[model samples]
Target: MSSPKQRHLLRLGLSCRKISAQVTNSATESIVAMASSTEQEFMPHYRSKLTTFPRPHRFWDANIASRVGEKLGFRLTDIGISDVEIEQPPLPTHHRKLIAPFLHSVKRAGISVYGSEKFESESQA
Candidate 1:
């Protein structure tokens, strides 16, 4: 049997075309994060979430705290999580010094560098 909220949603669903699977996991994570951050200040609520995924890692760990949890503020040591140090992941440097020169030389020699940021050459003035 549909609960009141479910029945209400069903009625709305007929009038809307934008239906998709529910956001159950994210919603639950947010609930937990909010409960955890009740007495917080300084960090904005949205910033507390650690949602950005930097590209360098070969694997993603699901167990890592949610973005909301991160935004809510966390102390890794107190959380009993570890490493002697903590640091933000390095961001990618999209520009390469050699890439511009290499591309110029190759195109002059009639070779085209193609596909992906790492190999693709950008034009420099």
Candidate 2:
């Protein structure tokens, strides 16, 4: 029998593995090609859409953003939408350090981050 904390950690680890498997199975091409190819070739302009989430101000938010980006091919710059009403402090360096490992893991799994320009042209069209 495990302690509550141990059980929670097990669950988290399992979830992470599931997500990683899904991303790896769905990987379409090399990260380099995905990053450099014109957006039209991979994602049709008419079908492209931008989805925004709250600005990340915490380590957890950063983790969520990184995972979402990996799954959807959205970069940090692509998903950020400023909210003047909600003024949050900048993420601490410690939090950034915590998020780095996960981001690197996604890269290792062949997930690429895409620039905002990918969506900008789509929106214009």
Assess each prediction's global lDDT (C-alpha) against the native.
0.24, 0.28
Please state the error at residue 39 of candidate 2 in Å.
33
Cα displacement (Å) at residue 15, model 1: 59
TM-score to native of every candidate shown: 0.19, 0.23
Candidate 1 error regions (>4 Å): 1-95, 116-125
CA lDDT for candidate 2: 0.28
What ranges in model 2 sit over 4 Å off? Answer: 1-89, 114-125
